[model samples]
Target: MDTIKKLLAAGKFDVVLNQLQERMLSDESEERKDALYYSAVALRYLGRLEEAHQRLDALLDCWSDFGRGHQELGHTMYALGREETALQAYYQALKLNPALYASWDATARIEAKLGNLQQAELNAEQAQFLQKQPKQVVGALNLFHEGKLFKAERICRAYLQRNPHHVEAMRTLALIGAKLDVLNDAEFLLESVLVLAPDYNRARYDYIKVLQRRQKFPQALAQAKLLRSDEPYNPLYKALHANLCSALDNHDEALSLYDELLSDKVGDVAGVYVAKGHLLKTLGDTKGAVACYQQAYQLQPLFGDAFWSLANLKTYRFDESEYQRMQAAVSANETRVEDKIHLNFALGKALEQQEAYDESFSYYRRGNVLKRETSQYKSEVLSQRVDAQVEYFDRDTVARWTHTSAQHRHLTPIFIVGLPRSGSTLVEQILAAHSQVDSTLELPNIPAIAHELNGRQVDRKKPLYPYILDELSAQQVEQLAQRYVDETRVYRSEAPFFTDKMPNNFRHIGLIKRLFPEAKIIDARRDPMDCCWSAYKQLFAEGQEFSYGFDTLADYYRDYLRMMKHWNQVFPGQIYTVFHERLVNDPELQITNLLNHLELEVEQQCFSPHQSDRSVKTASSEQVRQPINTKGIGQWRKFEAHLAPLKKALGDVLSEWAY
Candidate 1:
């Protein structure tokens, strides 16, 4: 850093550029980032703004989270007389590193020149405030924006130890925790910052995100309302408010807000169209949803999400021209990794619809490979989690640690859980067909509770959750149970029963039993190959990381089976298994047995669940909208020749499940 400053001061820009070029090529260390950054600075000083912009773009291609690169790019663009482009880059830089004083100053000047005095003053004030922060705090912010999260956390923690009241440091650390998926710790840190500085708008926005991730929808909605009131004209806050309303089942209001935002023709118009499409799809307005998704891609040709959403409908077909357009977009030089993933999946679906199986599989494999390259999932960690549950939740252990506390029986929650694409959604739709039941999307409350319990520490030791279940007091269990009920109330009506159909909740059965022993648990079972292959072929919006690879997905299915077997042994008859084949083969017998299990009278709606107007949000949404059929019963047979890896991974479990 001192050498770079001295070189700049000495007016040796060419020498600095040469040295940085060599370092960038030869050194793969952390210093490579500095080399890349300083090379751009040298290029800018040498009156080669285009070269500087190109180098910064390359830097960002390698590290998209590098805020400094964006800031430098902004400076280069400004020097090249592109004020609007520079402003966009500056906004992005501030989004990544709000403490970038120079970017703030630049933005203030640019906005003032554009005659936006209010925003200019706000940026100027931000610059002044950030200038007062310690250098260490600024360095930590830079590191955090560079995606060196662990190093940034260490620096932030060290700085906060000396200046604990630094709200920005707290916010940065909380954001790091969020990126690491330790949302509880992030929520705690942000909450503390807000308490100390109640008017901290940035911290409040982040707090809302943590709350949303934790499935505290009411709290998130409250925060969104506050932000909307503060800046009623801000499209970002209005979009968030609309999304929160949709999450809380206020579909009509969310649609209205989205329409209002769209009418203004504001930021990310294609994104607003996609959001409206999703809400319309959930409301069973298929034609309207299709039109919206089509409009989204038409407006932004590179927007792969719009294409993927259309394919995910499972009923949409692509013409040859549409396929060619997506292929071109996928191969485009400027297409981002995220967009490519979506395009590949969408193209795979399009090809599969045309019966081009090999080409379809290739696209699917490519998509999954790209997705896995960035995923943090490890099959071994999931294996250990399964093993922990088996070791900790045996019949004898449950009998000894069982909290004899009163289970919250005021509202019965029918839990439909199993592997992804294992007919859980279909089962939920059938059950929800009853007049006494309300269907909800995959509620995240149970998994959030499990995450909290698994992340709790004692004496700084590793978390012991299923094991910790043995030590919970009656009051604690009741409180946890009630919290689930209260958190889920937003998705409920006056119906006697509501379904929580989160397929991954199969892993948290023991926790469910501990909290709500009387709650009805339905294990929605399907043919292993069909279920695994189906999930492998689909791209989920989030979570279900195991589905991205074939062998890992099959092994995950095996683990799911092993865990389910253990749960059945530990608490026999508590869970009722519903086989997809049997249900489809004999609807009358299956529906009767299902109704008997729930202790409800059989309704005709259960037999014709497709006629119900309930919202379905799973990948099987389109499939469930039609009457039950055997079309998907043996889907694995179509890809049997290529499924040897999956079959081998499953081993004896395949024969045991009689697949």
Candidate 2:
């Protein structure tokens, strides 16, 4: 055994194997058992998994009291992807020594691979609890991988306290702080890691991420530059750099980088295609975006982000066949949690589009549940970690500004706000169809920016949003607002007016109105059940909280309505209401009214979105590809039978929509 260890430590794997062969006739039971286990592990690591399995079986048939040996065997089995055997090995190890954290961690990995996240988390917790010290970092990392953030934080912090210079511990702490929304803490921890180890490119890259999450754009850019200085050719750095540039509205530079990345030699760069698709979509080249999606799909079909994005570009109205295709795509593909949530929602939407209400509800329900959990992870986890008392804007500010702007006190820009699926895309498509108007699809990303501005919302009752309008000087507001307009200039170069249709802008109307007094705000409404349920069914890429399931979706719908009602009451005629059904039914009347409100000329194509050829990167893609049909007019009726729970929950609140 001692000789084998020396060979293994000296990197003499072949020598170790030869020694094992010689030990086939060892006189003692311990020597024989040792020889069998070592050979099995060596064989497994050497990729001779079948032989390793046979050897392991022979050993287990004889002596099996070695807990650590069983754990090592399980690790080898897991490496071979024989997960059931790995679980059995872990079970045997635990049967011998229940306190073994390695055995628990192995079990956790198997459970996670099977997608039993709850059980995986529980086992990870058990493993972590068994070894709650700095030496237990490995087990703690397993807990973190399983998304047990709180436990991971405790383990990491323990190490950080004793060994402040530990790079891995600091990196893990930074990540945990980021997830918990403690941006400052995360930033400090990561920066300290770099101070101790300036050559740590991975930590530098992750620092950029922390800055990005905090919406510290300039800092993020600076850190990104520093990172590039160290590793100029790293695709990961370039990708991150491209993302920051895009966020900063430096699209020209972003596009150039993205174009260069189109031929990226990196085998794992999926976002190059996604980035290319975004650039094309923004350029009004839907066909180009389609090609990019196809490329992305080819690279990773199980990548649900690609599938959902592709479905968003579909010309089919999510008809039954198209829905089946999306299902096949999702089923055939593997994905991250966010992508899975999106795919499920898209599948539900396709079912809804086909008038399969019950089936649609099932898909919507599943997607909504995932979305809620995701949101909880965000607001409860990420947001909680950031600096407290950071503020963001909401609709009340828009109302105040609209009222003032009407009085010529300010010139507010026009806002197109609603739930994502609630005619926001249609509104933009219709408005962009006009001669004087340009539409920038769901953008300006208010949530991330808001979180950054406020530092943290220490007291939710006194949110930073309400105070921003009363503070920021004219110059600051104008600069911030104008910078936004100039950045989006690519989308509206020729038009006199542009629409920002980011749905969550409903939360920041006050800031928008104050920034651009001339801004006309459009609050598009469909039936509550329709809008909420519709959103639940469709899969959005990012920054949507209500698209996952029924109860959570319903609550989110209520919050949206309540906020909108406050704005309407605060500044009545300033916010125009466009019923989605009415707009589809009387396109001309609604177009004329909507444009007249924006002080733009109504174009003939405004009513014919199908002719625009602009990419529809929302779930409404298929509907917009056809002439305004009454298919969606009675859409809520078919779902009414299946949405009894939703309807009962909504009560007469949906009566205003005249269900």
**Tens digits of per-residue lDDT for model 1, 91-197:** 87786677689999999999999999998998999999889878877787777765678898899899889889889888988988888788889999999998999
TM-score of 2: 0.64
Lowest summed-lDDT stretch of 10 residues in model 2?
382-391
Best by TM-score: 1
Model 1 residue 315 lDDT?
94
The reply for model 2, stretches above 4 Å from the true place, is 1-144, 151-174, 177-199, 207-235, 238-265, 269-301, 314-361, 377-412, 433-438, 444-496, 514-518, 601-630
Q: Backbone clashes in each candidate structure, one number apiece?
A: 0, 39
| lDDT score of residue 519 within candidate 2 | 68
List the candidates' TM-scores in order. Answer: 0.90, 0.64
Residue-by-residue lDDT tens digits, candidate 2, 1-659: 87788877777777778878978678787788889888887786678878887787667655444555677778778888788988977876775555578889889988998998986997898788657645656555555654568898888888768877778788877877777676777888898998989888878988999888655666788899988888777777887888788766676887777776767656245668877776666555668777776677667654566555655654524445545555765553123345556667667656655666788777767767766764652233223222121223344444344222222232234588877777777787887777666666565545444555555543464455445556666666666665565545544555566677777787666556566655688988887776766665566655575455555556666666766776666556788988888887888888899878876666788878767866555556656766776666545667677777777766657675562
Pull out the clashing pairs in model 1: none
Evaluated at residue 63, the lDDT of candidate 2 is: 49
The runs of at least 3 residues in candidate 1 whose Cα sits more than 4 Å from the true structure, single-residue gaps closed, are: 1-38, 48-67, 81-104, 107-132, 401-407, 456-462, 636-642
